[model samples]
Target: MDVSVIGSGYVGTTVAACFADLGHRVVNIDIDEEVVATLEAGEPPIHEAGLPELVATHAGPDSTGRLRATTDYEALLDTDVTFLCLPTPQHADGSIDLSIMEAGAEQLGATLAETGDWHTVVVKSTVVPGSTADVITPAIEEVSGRTAGTDFGIGMNPEFLREGTAVEDFQIPDKVVLGADDERALADMHTVFDPLVDAADAPVVETDTRTAEMIKYANNGFLAAKVSLINDIGNICKEFDIDAYEVADAIGLDDRIGAKFLRSGLGWGGSCFPKDTNAIIHAATEAGYEPAMLKAAVAVNDRQPERFLGLLDEHVGVADRRVAVLGLAFKPGTDDVRNSRAIPVIEGLQARGAEVVAYDPVAVENMRSHFPDIEYASSAAAALEGAHAALAVTGWDEFAALDAAFDTMATPVVIDGRRIIERREGLTYEGLTW
Candidate 1:
């Protein structure tokens, strides 16, 4: 299969590399020259586990030359299938700003007009239901002057890749969604994902474009709601002087409530959960239906950081004090800081006039852009050194091993958001919602 993927962000790069690894001739199309150059050089533009190896093996001089990158949208015309992996970022009012996806679709439509051969355009970007058929299809048809399902095929194939575990998720997804109106587009989608379908024996979900789009939103929304529910439950457990983990464990025994995303901590703060939940809420409201459960879930998630800071306040005054933030990334294994819980924690610390020192194994550089004035330490120990207190925002594995580092803190008070720390004699530990 000859594949072209647009947008070289996290999802774009991951799918491109993985597609190439699956024996497809892949070309990544992006507006960013640096990202295109980085891909051409066999280097991953983003930090994801198992991505560099895949890129190195399928792209560049030493590899099979099956994967390459270009800044030109016309390059996509040469490919049999094109995947729009663009970003549908959240707007000010929590509605999806589909300008990026629209622009990409217009350009792709124009590019497809140059070719006489049939091409399939798959919307792999996360979007609200009816977007693929209503927004994207119309945009492409308007620009190309070609009809969909006749001149060019359009499909909605949403991606389920997580930030840190994207490669593994792509390789072994629980299900492969194929959404298309016509038989040809459906067969094209199956062909594109045939290698993966055969490799993992993953279930194939055949549905319409709108349903496929809704599936992505519903999946993320449910997971986000689940975490928020547990966090709410954990908050109650804390009031009762009960261990939330024990409650979660007992609930896990029930077949209906399988315990994934059950770990209640600082709450979810990545690109997916917050954006998807807010978008759906906004969309649902506009349609005259209020999603009460999702609204409560978001309320719980939004208050977790404040709850964490309040716990810190119980030990000492943060005003004019130096506090250490143990992690900056949303989660371990990736350098993505978009909507990370650390942002709120740091902001709360700063609001109290606390001089903040932050540390992350790989996300420190990314965080510098968000907080240039805040000091960043090379090591977790360095961040903890002489600090009045420390807050663990991300549950990195290395944080679990920090037994002796607490002794060096000026006030060994640790407010753990992720429950990644253990109680020791020398340190004062407080879980945000244990």
Candidate 2:
């Protein structure tokens, strides 16, 4: 299958590379010249585990000519399938802002107007239900001057790739969803994903576009709620002076409740959870139904950073003192800092007049854009040195190995948010949930 992915952001780039590796000829189309150039140079524009190797093997010079990138919209006309991987950012009210997706569809439709052969356009981006049928399809139809399901096919294939393990997730997915109104679109999607389906032996769900969109939101919403529910339980356990991890471990023994997302600390905060939860909440409210449980989950996640800062306040006054913040990224194995719990933690520390010094293995440069004035240490030990107290925000594996670094702190106070640190002699350690 010859596939063209529009918008070379995180999803676009990863999907393009993975499809190429799956034995499909893929061309990544994006408006950014820098991203296109980077792909052409055989380098990934984003920081994802195993993405560099895939891009190097399939794209750039001296590699298999299965993958390439271009800045032209006309590139889509040559491909049998085009996946709309543009970002659907949120508005101030938490509703999905589909301006980018609509604009991309219009451009794609205009380019497709030149061709008479049927081409399938798959919505790979996460959008609210009814977005494809209501907003995106109309945008493309108005621009192309052609009828959908006739001249061009429309399909919705939501991506379930996690940032840290996107390549692995794509290669070995738990499930593959293919949604389309017409058999032509569905057949085209099946042809495009047949290689991956056969290789991974993954379950395939065939449904309508609306159901497919809701599956993504519902999937994220359930996971977000589950994390918050655990955090809520963890907070209760804290009140009773109970170790949440112990309780969680025992409860996880039950086959009904699995152990995944059970380690509750600062709650869920990444690109997908926050955006998808808020988007679904807003969509539910707009449809004359209020989702109270989802709203409470968001509230609980918001309160975690404050609770962490409050724990710091209990140990010592951070005002007029230096505080070492370990880990800036939302999770380990990825450098994405969007909606990281560390953001509010840093803000709370600053509100108390504390000098912030933060460190992450790969997220320092990304976090610099958020707090350029704050001190960024070269290493975890460097951040802890001469600081009044240390707060562990992310559960990086390196932080678990620190033994003597606590001796360098002026006060030797440690507040662990992710429970990656252990209490030892000559160090006052406080776990957020344990």
Top-lDDT candidate index: 2
lDDT of 2 by residue, 1-434 (tens): 89999988889999999999989999999989999999999999999999999999999899997999999999888799999999998888999899999999999989988989999999999999999999999999999998899998999999998989998999999999999988999999999999999999999999999999999999999999999999999999999999999999999888899988899899888899999999999999999999999999999999999998889999999999999999999999999999999999999999999999999999999999999999999999999999999999999999999989889889999999999998889988888887
Clashing pairs in 2: none
> How does candidate 1 fare on TM-score?
0.99
Structural similarity to truth (TM-score) of each candidate: 0.99, 0.99
- Candidate 1: tens digits of C-alpha lDDT, residues 273-328: 99999999999999999999999989999999999899998999989988999999
Global lDDT of each model? 0.93, 0.94
| Model 2 regions more than 4 Å off | none
* Model 1 local distance difference test score: 0.93
Give the residue spans of candidate 1 off by over 4 A: none
**Clashing residue pairs in candidate 1 (N, C-alpha, C atoms within 3 angstroms):** none
